[model samples]
Target: MINYRPKVFDEASKSHASKKLYAILLAFIVVMGIILILESIIPAIVSTKPMLEEMNENGYLENPDNFNFQESMKLAMKVSSSPSAMIPTLLSTIFGTVTAIFYCRCIEMRPVRSMGARKEGFFSHYITGIITGIILMSAITLLSVALGVNKIEICHGVNYKVIALYLLGFIVQGMSEEFIFRGYLMTTIGGAGYHTGIAVMISAVAFALAHAANPGFGVVPFINLTLFGVFAALHVVVFDNIWGICAIHSIWNFTQGNFYGISVSGSNNTESVFRTTAVSDKAFLTGGEFGIEGSIFTTLILSIGIASSIYLIYKRQQLQQKKQPSQE
Candidate 1:
């Protein structure tokens, strides 16, 4: 029998699937959904961070009745900004960890993991992440070229230090998202059932839809984002862990935004270490309105991602099975 302990309801130390698992998932999704809908209606409902309210309480947002569109956009963006580190950490532990423990109540997982107090560490799985990110970025870049939306000029410049810094920024961006989504969300959902297909699909959907509000919203980007979800879910199934996928996501974004200097998902990354000027003609290749991620090549890359994830997962399973009889 599989031994699992989700810290949601049971007082006993004995391992058993928590009865509250489904109820918890359903309730949280519904609540999050409602909150999102309300946010669309009233911008102030957007983020849980109190900073916006504090700003408004001060003269930062006085009689906005006299403000123009740009001012309004700034306010709207502010409402959705991230919270202070202390608050987010408190919430992640109280909320994010709880979701992880409960949502993935299906799998026989460890009550405590090697991921420690810092909530981060040396990415042992960093290599796999970089490969995955590179694959995705390459595909997107190729499509950008074909579409003529923008062109890229690779720098053979002697400024290797700038290039290195740019790459590091990319790594951080990919790692952060991967860690949060694939690592955090995936393992949490594993408790429900680690080896099953359904758990993976759920994670992927969550990953994709999270980007719905990004500046460029068309069918392709949405589809691409959904594919990202699928990619992330499958990635975790391979290692039965989250570290690799996090690095991939952070690096992927960093590369797309910083190094390429092309619009990343339609948003320009002027803050990136390297400044890249647009260099293409065909909007289709340029990914036109949606950015490189909006291209069909992105789909191909995702297909590869899906295949790689499956292959890795199968190999891991085989290794585990091979060890099982020896233990016996």
Candidate 2:
């Protein structure tokens, strides 16, 4: 019979101890610190000339006390659309991959492929994820439109090239997140003798916590984000790989911000093919400034997705068992 147990749970014996997992997690934190420092430093250096001129004209530097964190983050994202954004984004993923490798290969004494990063079927899974993401996000958009919760207008003079760059950025962003949360954190926790389902819940909680500080964040978005994590973990367990979830996460955000002109997790995307206008009074339905992901509909959709993924996993196992020879 086909086993429904996750390979990660089965491979727990090969994993490092709890202490080692903590150290590895600390290493990841350090790497993230380095990434944040570089992201800030490089951008500051590039903008030094303008900043200096503005400071001189104003007779003083901008006051830190009056700074708005949300607005600043949005502005930073807008500015990062240029080539410069690639550095931090790429570094984040590369360093994240390095951390995973260090733990899997060095600490755990296992092959990196044991972490479900095998190249076989990578492209196919990624393509499937992209389609899945498109369908989900499009459905959410259509529902909002039908209910008069959102108004979407086509932007005639859209810059396809910029949109392409943003797509690349979101792809990297999504892959990095998947590598950390699904590939690294989930595997580590599950391989530490904990139940794989528990690991999934923990990782999902962490995923939601990471985005807790995002703009327009609310209870609905928090729950939806957690559900997304559970869905992604189940996806990995079913497919035995991470490529598909990475693609889904990437395309989901990209379509929300770049294709549909919605605020992705509350970060405004000024460049898009469509301009989305949310009904001011329908924040519960339209997700307000947090975009559609913060809505009740998103919760329903994600719940369905999670259940479907679980069903598919079991169904696939049944099919595989049916193809085997009888013991008799």
Candidate 3:
């Protein structure tokens, strides 16, 4: 009896979006292209000298013959680990948000509000999401420490400036992915007459596949990422807005990388307040090179989050049903 799709889903359906698969493919091309262009141009403009210096020091220049995939990846990691380079890299994600919004709003003629860009209660929802994000991540980190899978140490000579930059960058980066995946993709599919479960599953799978190229991305990481997608999608459905998910995504990444000094989804560590290092070689426990996001702990937490969201959706549906009788 619990069945109630959000207003945004119905709104998107009324827009008559193109066939789901075709829409997803075209949007992928458009959004990825913009992100690629901005990612390349911004880094080139902002971190050109520092990147070159790092590359040369890493022997990329002196030993061109030996520069292989591993060497290339090493250089890439160095760039990502550097705050100046990472800022531009992260900031470029805004294009992903913009491209998805433009495609849905202008091309499909869908209203922006249909994508959960609502103004009412935006601040409240966002603040709540931030709190939720901090708690979830803290639980994972703390639990890991308690089990002796990881150890935390305060960073010496920490650069508050770089940490601030990362915080700003993660805010944009997190919101971009939410807008693209949850706000745009999931709703578009659901609105096109697909079952809500199908919409959520497809979007979740797509999210996991998108991260396949990252370092240390294995089966566990893929599962964890997909579960995260499911959690986020359900949260959106229950809250009936995108702002909460955006804040959650932003704070989740910020807390993981900047607050805990852990690698963010297989990326190298950046400026963090405290460094969390693995005490064991168990990939299931420490997540190996992918960081805690890939660990079994993440799987457990995301599963709980998913379950909680499902319950909320059900309760909301029940409340609506109770009101229907009075109105009649």
Best by TM-score: 3
Instruction: List the lowest-lDDT window of 10 residues for candidate 3.
Output: 15-24
TM-score of each: 0.62, 0.82, 0.94
lDDT of 2 by residue, 1-328 (tens): 2236577555644765453557656755665565455445655666555445544454444565544565456455555544445334433454555555665678667656656787899889999999999988888887788888888999998888878877877887788778778777777767666666777887788788778877788888888899999998899888888899989999998888888889888775557899888765777888876778899878888888988987887798787678776643
**Which lDDT tens digits does candidate 3 get at residues 1-328?**
3446888889888665576678666766676667667657877777667767877887878888888888777776777667767888889888888888987888778999988889999999999999999999999999999999999999999999888888889999989999988888888888887778878888888888888988899999999999999999888899889999899999999999999988889998887899999998999999998999999999999999999988888888889889999999
Candidate 1 global CA lDDT score: 0.53
- Determine the backbone clash count of candidate 3: 0
User: Candidates' lDDT values, in order?
Assistant: 0.53, 0.74, 0.86
Candidate 1, residues 81-130, lDDT tens digits: the string is 32222222212322333333433343424343411112343366767667
Show the colliding residue pairs in model 3. none
Candidate 1 vs candidate 2: which has greater lDDT?
2
After superposition, which runs of candidate 1 have C-alpha atoms over 4 Å from their true positions?
1-21, 27-71, 74-124, 146-149, 154-176, 272-285, 315-328
Better model by lDDT, 1 or 3? 3
Model 2 clash pairs? none
